[model samples]
Target: MIAQVQKPIEEILEYLEGRDKVVLVGCGGCATVFHTGGEPEVKEMADILSRHGKEVLAAIAPPFGEFTCYAPWSSKRLSKYRQEIEECDAILMMTCGDGLQVVRESVIEGEFGLLKRIYPATNPTGHMGGGPALFKEKCQQCGECLLGKFAGICPLTQCTKGLLNGPCGGSQDGKCEADPERDCAWMLIYERLKKFGELDRLREAEPMLKDYSQMTRPRKIEVAPLVLE
Candidate 1:
């Protein structure tokens, strides 16, 4: 699930920017999982828009109790939910980043063509961190790894320099360079392996650097026709 955080009435109010029949499309998946993305917040958003003097054409979504994962996860069948979005002049997606992108792409590819303006209510975050482990900052999205061996404790994914291996020796008492409260990623990795009795795996020194293939810029993945069909 991808997410965009829209705070301050202005970010959305500005989008209304003199239009009244504004439509808000709330994502069932992102909203159900995260408290901020759900219908109460959507209602508050609608109220905010209404208070700002814009007419909220409608707020379209299933009732609050539906489970997002077990439910459909796209705008692919916007027709299933198009009327809500169509009721207004614009769309405000409360889904994660990918959901919004998928919807927008589909709308562009579909017949309802009501795409006037769009805004993300939350920043898109990947599915890795799950619910509570939400990334406070970012991963740098470095595709390299120090995780497969270190019992999944990643010095690189958690480290600031993206160090390929081992601690910089700058970590004090297992605390990280970036934050003392956070454990040094390498140290945590080391401890994890020790606990799992996989210390022998550490003797296998990893390569001097990562394979650049994964580092290739602007990656894109496409399934062949067999997968599509």
Candidate 2:
């Protein structure tokens, strides 16, 4: 999931300095999980904007599991607000950057064929895993899978320096020197490998270099449509 946090109200207000009519849209996916852009957040934002003298035409939020980043889902859900969307001077997107862009490019500009100023209210930190109580970044989406070689621990993400060959030799008492609050990633990997009797893999390894060319930005994929029985 994409982890995100809401931008400060001061910053959001600055973006609406000259705009009056506003439409607020919230996400039901990551933003909901992070308490950044859920239904309640959208209502709160609408009230806040109203108190600030900005007229809120509509406040819309998708149901949980309906991601605002998906073109079809967002377009369908937002179609009912076409009139309000067109009348609004600006849109306050209480979602991650992707959701904001999708709403602008796919829903507003593509479907409606009308250009409107859209602003993001949340800042995405990174793709992460773990939920219910907490979330932590687990992958960088580098377009390569090396977890099999490292006993499922990703050094590129967990290690401070993304060291692949071995530890940075700066850890003390199993704590990372760069980040004293966290245990050394390499130490964790070493312990895991030792427990599995796979320590020889580390000994026979050489320094590794990541092929970043595979990680070209704006990557896309085309998948076959799902067939329901």
Candidate 3:
């Protein structure tokens, strides 16, 4: 999981100095789990702004993240906040790059075409766990969730060596043969899979030099706006 932290209060104060009425926006999905920013942070921000004599119009929550499932199903959530966000001086986005970009574009044409915007917040860094908690994994951006396929473990992405099969028998007692801090990739995978009932997927025989064009590295996808008839 990625562990993202918010910027210093002084830094945010600089951007929010002039704006009296502002909207503190948070992605309840990601921002909530990442613990980077949320209503608590918003309240903290509000306190700071109020100390400096700024009136926060509202603190709005939207559903966002890699899984943008919540907002689409619950349109009423954002619909209620649209007026507040539009009329307000600014929106402090507490989300990932993707979520923030969408929020920024949500305002099509402002009165000034320059509604003061700022990403004064820090970037998100980590993986989403089973309970949707952030696990603070390194920013590998592996683009592959091999943990499931590997019997609830990840060797390719987690292992420093990027070993697909795993470390040789030299690895002892979960510790990596090469490094103590790191566990033996294959051993961990084997044990985890054995714990789970899906060990059958393990013996499926992974191919060497397989073409994964669909799962290309550093993959970027093109997204067109939704066309509603």
Candidate 4:
């Protein structure tokens, strides 16, 4: 899941400066799951904006399945609220950057003039696990999967120093030197490998350094179109 945290109210107010008649758009996907942009949060934002002397023209929660980051879905869902949105001076999107981009694209394609500014109200923290209490970041989306070699622990994230090979010299008593509160990532990997009798895997030559070229920016993929014979 995409983890996110609410932006400071002062930052939001600054973005909304000189703009009244605001329309609030909330996401029902990751933001909702994180309790940062659900219906209740949207209403709370409206109240705060109202108290700040800004008029809230509407607070819209996109219908289920209409994820705010899916352009086609969000575009269709937003059509019904076009009039209300057009009437507003700005839109405060209680969602991550991806959702904000989707909404902006919808507004452009829907021919709602560029006069209406779209602003993000939440900052994406990182991708995380789905459990209620599992807020810790689990993956870095580095365009590489090293779980098999590391025994499922990501040293890039779990280790304070992001050591790929093994425990640093600073590790003492299975505790991390960077942060004594956390277990050393390499130690955990060793214990896990030992339990599985796969310690020989570590005896192999160290893996090559990660190639970041695979993670080039503005990446995209396309599936070939199907044709009937």
- What is the descending lDDT order? 2, 4, 1, 3
Ranking by TM-score: 2, 4, 1, 3
Q: Which stretches of candidate 4 lie over 4 Å from their true place?
A: 63-66, 106-115, 222-229
Tens digits of per-residue lDDT, candidate 2, 31-140, equal 99988999999999999999999999999988898889887788888999999999999999999988999899989999999999999898899999998978888888
Q: Any runs in candidate 1 off by more than 4 Å, and if so which?
A: 1-4, 62-72, 81-87, 108-111, 125-146, 215-229
What is the lDDT, from 0 to 100, of the residue 158 in candidate 4? 88
What is the per-residue lDDT of model 4 for residues 1-229, given as tens digits with 9 covering 90 to 100?
7789999999999999999889998888888887788888999999999999999988888644456876666666677788878788899999889899868875644545556688999999888885776788777777788889879999878888787877778989999998899899989998998999999988775655777777788656566743422
Weakest lDDT window of 10 consecutive positions for candidate 3: 66-75
Clash pairs detected, candidate 3: 1-126, 1-127, 1-135, 1-136, 1-137, 2-125, 2-126, 2-127, 3-125
RMSD of each: 4.4, 2.0, 5.4, 3.6
Position 147, candidate 3: lDDT: 62
lDDT of 4 at 57: 87
Compared with the true structure, the alpha-carbon lDDT of candidate 1 equals 0.62
Compared with the true structure, model 2 gives a TM-score of 0.93
On a 0 to 1 TM-score scale, where does candidate 1 land against the true structure? 0.75
Q: What is the lDDT of residue 12 in candidate 2?
A: 97
Q: How accurate is candidate 4 locally (lDDT)?
A: 0.82
lDDT by residue (1-229, candidate 1, tens digit) is 4434555566766766767777666655556556455778778778877887877776655455432222133433455666666666677766665555656665633556766666666655554445564634334455665567668766556665566567778899888877888778778777888899998887887776778788687665664422210
Using lDDT as the measure, the top candidate is 2
